[model samples]
Target: MRVVHVASEVFPFSRSGGLGDVLGALPAQQARLGAQVTVVSPWYADITQAVREVWRGPLEVPGSVPLTDVRVGAFTEGGVQFLFVGLDAFDRPGLYFPDDVWRFTQFGRAVLPALEQVGVVPDVLHGHDWQAGLVVARARLAGLRAVFSVHNLQYQGRWNLMDGVGWTGLPDGVFTAEGLEFHGDVNLMKAGLVFASQVTTVSPTYAQEITTPEYGEGLDGLLIRLTHEGRLSGILNGLDQERWDPRTDADITPFGQLAGKAACGAALRAEFGLDDAPILATVSRLAEQKGMDLLIAALPELTRAWNVVVLGGGDPRLEAGLREWDAHPRVAFAQGMNEPLAHRIYAGADAFAMPSRFEPCGLSQMIAMRYGTLPVVRETGGLVDTVPHEVGFRFAGATPEALADACAAARLTFDDHAEWAARAQEAMSLDFSWDGPTREYLGLYARVLSGPLRPLVGLERA
Candidate 1:
């Protein structure tokens, strides 16, 4: 099977969060499983780190709009094949740029002609998030099969009706609650859901969540209808084990050099400046969705027992909360994404915290588990899927008390080296690799091909 992925971000090239990690990991994993995959993403100025120029040509977008097509070489670390489509529109520094809707709309419409120049028409064009949502809508009119993956439903790309309608050139009938319209505006995510042959969320629980009013962000009714019509499915995202594995990682240095607990504990102390206190780390975007506020609320009680290190960046509230805290030797907050630092944090920390309010499929917990760091997570989404029952601590509620108690339990558990070692072994043994998810995706693809949804979709070149 041939699969083409169109998204705004792919890991190592453009990554703000888990979506980029997923885009980077899954495509390579799918390739290893015998599916030829090519991903088209924006070539940001900072993308110089991961992209090398490959092929260049003139391509038409938006069903006759022409744009310069600069194809760039992409390195796939795991098993996936990656190709960065560099466009003059993306020559600017910002990905969303001054006009986000216009930029992505142009990106969505431009993918077909770009792929044609690459000399391959995939059996399925997979769109991730609202960034590539318009691709499926364009594909539908052009006679091609399209699949849409919703990383987060709340982040639907909504724009003015005039701008969106003018960009796609689809009929006015396409803009409705059942179509692209949401609250009198054009919703990019809604269009993908309505037009794609298959609509999938990252987890089954999340898939169920989005069909309800609470998690749907007003699109639950439509999602419920889609599921009722047998169009929606869920597959948990997987981690790239090659990079996440503790045993072989160069980032951890001396700690990863020795596997069993004692050496790791010593090395971890030096890495995080928590040589005396038990270190508890949480690496995530400092946002409401991740429940960073809850983590902050629990900190006063937490500081009494364990050393805490937070690695993340987002809302100013989080930065303020971290900065405003009473400076203690046991607590430190490293704000932002530093890959080596992240790997070291995962390796060195005694425990990892992920008290997410609603995690679609968190990679941090899985990465932590792989590094043999026990996870204290809310029993939701991928956190539940990845963290083993015996390996880590879990709470049902998404509250400060729940998170605090989980951390307390983790701290107490950490004191017991024997039990921690046992759990660490178990956590390390858990398989959150891409192989399982990739096979599941392939099965979904085959099912879609056999089903009635196949012929209904179309793809047109610009």
Candidate 2:
């Protein structure tokens, strides 16, 4: 079957966060499963690979419906196809800049012509996030079957009714409260929910959470409606083991110790310039959503015994504060994206911390688990699903105290060689592969295409 993944970002080319990680890994896995998977993304500046421009043709969208010529590029890596839609507007550093509505709408509308030109009409159009949701919706309207995955529903592409309706060429009725419109704006994410043959969230727990107002971000009612209509489902995301494995990782100095935690800790400390002080690391986009504020607030109390190394940059306030603290005797903050450094941190840190207030399905915690570093996480989203009670410590509440206490618990394991070793071995042995999710998706696609659930899938919830 042919499956086309539409998104604004793809890993190793244009990456902002876990969304890129998912796109980079999942398509390859789907290809391995015997499906022809292609990714459609915007051309960003950081993408250095040689991309061939395949077409420059006019596209017809809703409003202006002008057959304005759009540039198209084709690039393939790891057996997965990529279509980089080039707009003089989107060719800038940012994927969505001045007129984001026009940029994405044009990208969405232009995909059909591009696909037709390539002589490949996909069996399933799998769209991701809001940036690409309109493309899937437009594809569906163009008589293609589409599956929409909500990595996070909070970032709905919403615009004022006049501007959105004009750009999308959508009916004025779609600008209402219940349709593609929300609060007098046309919401691209909502349009995906309304038009997609099926809607999927990253995790089962998140699927349940988004139905409530707290995590829903004003789209809970819409999700609940979709749930009632039997169009919504949840599938947990998976880590790319090829990039995350400790044994073959090119970044970390010391290799894997399949059975001992003490030896691993010692090796890690030597590599990171920490002398036996329990090294705790965090790799995350420093944002309020990631609970970085709480992490910083808890640091004063945490610096008594442990050494902290932070990687990642976002939120100027958090970045600037971490930069100041980087000079501290025990704390180290790298302050930007360093993949090798991240792998080193995962290998070297005695414990990894992720205190997200709400995590849809974090790849870092799983990557940390692969490195045999115990994770100290807030119990939410995929963290709740992946981080077992025996593997590490969990904080029940989204408070500094809860996070601090979890860190303290992880530190205790770090201090006790035997306990930490056993936990590390257990985490390393666990499997968090894409095989399961890919199979689930295949079954879901078969059901949608055939007009009902297949007997082999047995949709009763695994």
Candidate 3:
């Protein structure tokens, strides 16, 4: 199988969330399974760290930015090929920007030809999120098979119709409501949902949730149609087990030994200047959606019993809310993306808390589990799918009270030495490996490319 993934992010190079992790792992695994895999992502500013060689550019891209002046580059590794589209529109710190329509629209137009230029005709063109929605549409125009994955439905990438129809070079009537148009604005997500040969999301429950207005972000009705037509699928994401493993990860050091957790907790407490107590750590984006507000609100109540470590920075106001608790003896806040610290936090903490108001497919919960730190998440999205009842705690509401109840349950569990250790062992034993999801993806690919369509069977539950 010749497969190409078009996305704005990938790991070890670029990432914002689980989208990058999923895109990176899925393709690499596909390559290992004997598929010829190529991943094309934007060469953002920090791409200087990547080992790449300048490739021939000036590749003509119709209806968008000319690749002629844009210098193309590429790097290959481990049986998979990586390509980067270097242009001012993509050369930025963040994966997204205000003018993303122009940026990725041109990128979508360039991807198919880029593959052809490299002497490969893909059997499947895979697109991730709204960033690659246009790529899926372009694949259909070229009469090729394409799969569009919706990592998050909330971010639809809506823009004006004038810019959409004018620059997209799409056929007439495509901008209508039945197509990519939604309430007079161009919805990039809809473009993929409507045109792709198959549509997939992260987990089965989330796929079901999205077809309802409650979780749909206004695109539920359309998704329901697609699901009924047997063109929609949900494959739960898997983690890079090698990177997150406790036995091999250097960062997991002292924590992996017998009685190491006690020393680990003490060291982390000293580093954060917090009181010695049962530690709850959150290495999550400081945002309302991650249930940061509930965590903050419940902190006064939670800190009274547990020492808490908060990491990751985002949304000034949310960070401020967490910072206000910094003076508390049991509360510590370390802002920003500290990868080493994150690994340590997972290893050191007694419980990893993620009271997300919504989650597509959370890698942190799985990452925390890999380190033998139990997860406490609100019962929603991927959280509903992954948090095994025997291993982690789950709460229903996005309220402080509900979250506090869950944390209390976790702390109680922690008090039981044998029980807690047993649960942690069970959590650690989970197979969140790329094996299952990759097989499902290949099955989906084969099904989409071949004869009569049917629902994918034997999907592994996270």
Candidate 4:
């Protein structure tokens, strides 16, 4: 099968978050599984210099921008073709610019032509998140099958109706209640949710959560209808085991050797000037959605038993809040993204804390578990699916007290060396690899291919 993945980011070339990571690993895995895969993403200013030009032409953009210069650059890695689309609007410093609505609108418009220029007639166009949402509608109009995956529901690409409607060049009728319209705005996400052959989220629990009023982000009614129509699904995201493996990682002591994790832990404690206490580490963005505020509130109680190390930066207020703990004897806060430190923290920490208020599917917990570090997470989204009682600790409520309780439980297990070792071993042994999820995607694609194209209901071609 031929498959094309359209997204704003792809790892090793351009990445901002989990969507990039997923696009990086999933397509490669699919390629390994015998599907001819191609990933299309914007060629941002900071993209690696390694991507060479392969195709270039004038792209016929509809609506406002009638035509623009389009360049397609590519390289093959892990049997999958990586295609980068270049346009002046995307020649910015960041993967996501301030004018993202217009930038990705152009990106969405460029996808099909980019594919055509590269000679790829895909069986399925899998678009990720709101940034790539409009591609689904465009693909469908061309009679191609498309699957839209919602990585996070909260970030629907919304803009003023007049501006966004013109950029899409879709029929005026499509900007209505049954189409891309949402609360008097043009919601790009709604286009995918309403018109795609299938709609999927990152995890099973999240898929169910998004169809409810609590987590739906005001699209519950539409999601409910899609679920009933048998077009919505949840396939749990998987880890790229090779890149995250503890066995071959040169950053820390390899898993089975002498001193092993203990040596790494000792070194980490010394690096941070932390005292000899059980270490609890968190490698995450400091945001409320990640439950950072709750973690901060629980610090006074938590620091009594476990030394804490935080790596990552976001939300200046949250950053300031966490910095106050830097003076505490048992807490170490390292702001910003440090890849090497993250690997070390995963290997050395006794337990990893991911107290997310609502995580769709987190890669950090899985990475921590892979390094024989236990995960203490709130029971929501994929956290509920991956971290079972036997492998890690979990809490129900999204509160400081609940996170503390979970950590307290993990601390208890940490004190019992034998039991802790057993649990850590079990976690490392569990398979979070992409092999299973890749096969599941292939199956979904086959199903989509056999089914007829979903009608646009009230939508019309321009």
Best by lDDT: 4
| Model 2: ten consecutive residues of lowest lDDT | 453-462
Residue ranges of candidate 1 with Cα displaced over 4 Å = 49-81, 94-98, 254-261, 454-462
- Tell me which of candidates 3 and 4 scores higher on TM-score: 4
| Residue pairs with backbone atoms closer than 3 Å in model 3 (clashes) | 58-68
Candidate 4 clash pair list: none
CA lDDT for candidate 4: 0.89
lDDT of each residue in 1-462, candidate 1, tens digit only: 889898899877788888898988888878878888888887777776655566687665543345665565565555656677666667777555547777777777777766776686888889999988888887876778888999988788889886778776666667665578789888898889888888999988888878877788898888988898888988999888887877677776534422654566567566556747777888989998999999899998888888888888888988889877637677788887788888878887778889888888888998888877889999877777778779999998889999998888888887898888889888877888888888989988887777664443222112
Report the alpha-carbon TM-score of model 4 versus the true structure.
0.98
Score each candidate by Cα lDDT.
0.80, 0.81, 0.82, 0.89
For lDDT, candidate 1 versus 2, the one ahead is 2
Q: Which 10 consecutive residues of model 3 have the lowest summed lDDT?
A: 453-462
Ranking, lDDT, top scorer first:
4, 3, 2, 1
> Which RMSD does model 2 reach against the true structure?
4.5
Question: Which scores better on TM-score, 1 or 3?
Answer: 3
Worst 10 residues of 4 by lDDT: 252-261
Q: What is the TM-score of each candidate against the true structure?
A: 0.91, 0.93, 0.94, 0.98
Candidate with maximal TM-score? 4
